[model samples]
Target: MARDYAARCPVYPVRNAWLVAVAVLLAAQEIGAPKVQVAEELEAYPTESVELSCQFNDGGGLTKLTQVSWIWEPSDGHRDNIAVYHPVYGQSFPNVAFKDRVVFLHNSLENPSIRISNLRMSDAGRYTCEYATYPTGNEQGTTTLIMLSKPKNSANGVTVQAGTKSVVVARCEAADAKPAATIEWLAPVGGNHSTSTTSGPDGTVTVRSEYRLVPTPADNGREVICRVNQKTQKQPWVYPIKLSVEYLPSVSIEGYDHNWYVGRSDATLVCLANANPEPTTITWTAASGPLPETVVVEGNKLTVRKVDDAVNTTFICEVKNRLGSSRHQITTVVIEALEDPSSAGVVAGAVIGSLLALLLVVALIAVLLTRSRRQQRRGYPSSGDSIATGSGGSNGGDYGNKARLLFSNSGNNSSKNGTGTNNNGPIYTYREGCDATGTLTEKANDYHHHHLHHASTGNAPTAHDILLSSEMDEAERRKFDLDDSMEEEEERYDRFGGVAGGGNILPPAYHVHRGHAGEEMDVYLDDDMESQRDGSVISRTAIYV
Candidate 1:
């Protein structure tokens, strides 16, 4: 295989010539491309200093660094050479707008960064770092400089008269801001707001807002806030103000209690008014006639020295402001006595209490009467004779014994009927005796062996039954007299067939009395007899024959 290859070596030399040509083309492309480094964007506040950085890359030393320049390009597409730096010629500021404000930092073409002092809003523009190289020509990079200005905010309310049509009540503004500010309004009441913007020559904008409403008296002193939002501020600036709306004076009178009475003092009436401008004049008058001498007028108050008949009239209070005047009236009536509102309740309560007390008393009396009747029904025991015998005088015992013996003799003398019907009236003795005070005093321990029966037939009550009846009213019982008892006794004798002329019954007028005992006695019929002190009738003669 190591034989002579002279013909193949000639083809290899032709391929090597093409490879060498491609290498030279790539080497020239890399040498001609150079780079200038700068930030894409930058920010600074007004009147503050900022550095625009720029650096040139000569593509691995294939191209040479010549001179570097800083150019200002505004948004309007206008360019100016502001600063330039060269290794031999040093640094130069060509633009008069940046002559004293901009300077080259390093005085070398590799790093041509510039420091801009006393920055203004107008200085906000795109800055270009341009490099002039030998074979690569011009290489550039741009950086935008943003200048921020925080807005000064203010708000105020306008004074307006109350009207039907809508008017501006408040205004807010944010002035001298680089970026336009957005405005908004906050009001509790019903209203509308509008906004506008203005631009300044130095790239600052002014924002304004107005709040409008149909002004009314109620809208006065209402708080409204204006909020401004700008790019330069972290939080929105708020301004608060109050609206002022004026109207006519609304007047009224106060402090009348309707309890003004004669001889009463410390009464007063005050004139109250609502107006934007305070009321200037307050007047008091009387509709019936001139004001009373008891009334003392000072400012808006009318004080009464003393209430009297002359104060019983209509009173008027008038007030006037800058806008208009208003008045109020009250009718007063001086009464002879103070009208106490709680007096009616007190009277009603007293009446109720009295009625309750009366009911309690009635219940107590009923209980006492019931207990007394129960004792009587049980045959109440006593220490003396079973029959109720009274001792009106020293001979009272002898009189009672003789009367009982007479009654026994009469019962035995009565004859039997033809049918042997036992026709004899029952003799009844008093179960209780009364005193002069109309109260029963004597009580019987036992009902003596005296027969008692009803006068008429058919279940009618007897005299003894009527006397013991609890249903009888106390007042009616007090009206009972000895004459009535005698009449009842005579009826009973007749019913039982007692012959009055045959001496079977005692005479109705028969009486026993002890005048020396000082006992007052009577038997009543047609008001001829007077009442007895012991409520008993006695025969004046003690002879039973």
Candidate 2:
């Protein structure tokens, strides 16, 4: 085996060795690699600062921690170093422009992150984070930077009267930022300034600026303004302001009172006038009357200490300013004293007494008329009986026999015996008398047979006997009959029949008779009568006297 140690050359073998080298290269490319990616592509509000971080994964075992750096390459092609960190030597270096403003935020072998602060418009550019190992050489991650600008407010303009203060406000807003902004105010020359800040719902910030100023007379034609500031950029933003002022006079006055009563001791009135420039003077005049010497006038008020009985009086107050004059007036009235209560009361009482007397007279007349009517009604007499004298002349008499018989029958049984006048003015007399006839007929039927008798004179008749014959059957007779002889004598003259004599005459000589033999009588008459044949009859037979 030692003797054959000679070399053998073959082309296929060389070709196979070339293929193996190519395969090794492909495997290295697939197994270990450096990759770059960005977490956030965009940002806002540079005042809050920003960070760009680079990370490595699955690094082929060549981790010797060679190099890591951050750079800014502007759109204009200018490049500047930001930060460089090396594990072996700690922090290698940092750019002078960003020495204290940039930060390296990593301590491990995996991360290379950088932070920049106090950003300005010039710093906005493309930034790259690069990392390298001993064998892998280098890998980089990139991001774009944009500097935020502060929000600006619109111009504001306002005008105010001279010596008067006015307020003006302006607002500006910016949103979705890392940090909030501030607000400020700017006023015109010789004006005032103020400011305030607030946050919004979407992480935005708002600035409110306010301005106030008391304009001078010279500033009447000028202007003033308000402005807002959001400090997102380097330069402070500005807003314009315009202001105007006006001037005029003001007048005020006071007097004793709006409503004044007459007879005041002394009235004082005053007038006051003020303006940007004080007024010159004030004067007062009477609008319609010669002002009383008692009137006192002051700066703005006038007083009349004593007032006389003036029917019409007026006071005018006038004030003068540099530009013009103004005047006002008040009027008053006076009258005589009021009447006393005593006199007024006397007049009123007299009126009431006169009315009462008139009413009394009217009532008296009505009563007299009513009484006269009643008396006339009662003066008429009822027809019943009359009487005739021996001379054969008729006379008016009282109630006739029929009426007397009814009274006589009722009186016989009545417990009370008296003389009384009926509503018709007829006098009735009642007394006890005998009804001797033992008649079997009803009382109503027996009334027809009974004869009533009235006195020929005023004297009532005495009791008399009523006899019937024993031969007659007393029980069978309907009523007792008066002896025909006695009745015949009583009716001797036809003058007493009907109402000829007794029925219509008042009784002076004749009176009512009752209780004579069971009879009673009522007397009624209208006037004295001599005979019943001579009186006038209107509706019925009249008694004549």
In terms of lDDT, the poorest run of 10 residues in model 1 is 436-445
Tens-digit per-residue lDDT, 30-100, candidate 1: 66644888899999998899999988766567878788888899879999999888788888888998879
lDDT of each: 0.66, 0.49
Name the runs in model 1 displaced over 4 angstroms: 1-34, 338-368, 381-545
* Model 2: per-residue Cα lDDT over 37-124, one tens digit each: 5454646454578778777664455555577778888767888877887777777445687788887788655787777777655576
Q: Using TM-score as the measure, which candidate wins?
A: 1
Q: What is the lDDT of residue 344 in candidate 2?
A: 85
Q: Estimate each model's TM-score.
A: 0.63, 0.40
lDDT of 2 at 291: 61
